[model samples]
Target: MAAKRILIIDDEADVREIAKVSLEITKNWDVATAASGEEGVTLASTYHPDAILLDVMMPKVDGLATLVKLNENINTCKIPVILLTATIRLATQPAYVEAGAKAVLIKPFDPALLGGQIESVLGW
Candidate 1:
């Protein structure tokens, strides 16, 4: 099978690097990183990744806002998005789901299991 392509959008460089390495090493997936939501949205449209790992908090455009933009764009709307957040409250799940997030992954996740978690969430 072709390697799954994933785009990770996070303000933290370390997080993006960790996720890139984790996904690449564990699942042998094609991973791309964006330092901000704007870049992530641009890449999502052009790269047409299989899925997106989006951080919930950002300076200008937050994850929810970014998701909305992706959903608005014809090229990116179909791609599934999984939010990575430090704050995961039960009340927010419905909001995230309603905003088109496939799942919400808690922060400080185990890099070794990141690939499996994504696969499970995406049903890949």
Candidate 2:
């Protein structure tokens, strides 16, 4: 099997670094990082990652808006998106589901389990 390509969008530099290193080292996945939702959307359309790990809160465009923009683009509409939040219980949230997020993962996640969580949610 090929390495899974993942795009992580977050405003916090530390968060992005942590997730990027974690995913690359733990899962051997090709990971991309974007510091904002707009950048993430742009990257998604071109990079065409297998999945996107999007931050819920952002300055201009949030994850929900990014998801919508991604869905609107033909090149990126099919990629699965998973929302990341510092808060909890978004997995059961209607708005996130309605916004096209496949799942919601909490912050401070176990790096070792991140791949498993994504695989389980996406049926990878």
Candidate 3:
């Protein structure tokens, strides 16, 4: 079977690199990184990844807004998205899910277990 692909959308270069390394090396999955929401949309559209790890806060376009835009496009709507945020309040989880996030992950996460966590969320 072909390898599963994941798109990571985050402003922090280090976080994206860490995630890419973990997912690619440990999970043996194809990984793509985007620095902004617009770039994320473009990459995701082109890559058609199995899942997306999106940061909640960004300069040009925030994660929620970006997710809505992603869902607006039929080609990208079916892809699962997980929100990566430092501040995940009780009130926001439901809203994020309502906004189309499959899961919410706190920042400063364990890079070692990150792929496993994503697999658990994806029920893989």
Report the number of the highest-lDDT candidate.
1
Q: How many pairs collide in each candidate, listed in order? A: 0, 0, 0
TM-score of 3: 0.97
Per-residue alpha-carbon lDDT of candidate 1 for residues 16-109, written as tens digits (9 for 90 to 100): 9999999999999999999999999999999999999999999999999999999999999999999999988998899999999999999999
Per-model TM against the reference: 0.98, 0.93, 0.97
Superposition error at 17 for model 1 (Å): 0.2
Model 1 stretches with alpha carbons more than 4 Å out: none
Pairwise TM-score winner, candidates 1 and 2: 1
User: Which RMSD does model 3 reach against the true structure?
Assistant: 0.7
Model 1, position 66: C-alpha lDDT score: 98
Cand. 1 TM to true fold: 0.98
Report every candidate's CA lDDT: 0.96, 0.90, 0.94
lDDT of 2 by residue, 1-124 (tens): 9999999999999989888898898889999999998899899988989999999888899888898998899999999999998876635478889889899898888888898898899998
Which sequence of candidate numbers ranks them by TM-score, best first?
1, 3, 2
Candidate 2 residues lying further than 4 Å off, grouped into runs, are 89-92
Which parts of model 3 are misplaced by more than 4 Å? Answer: none
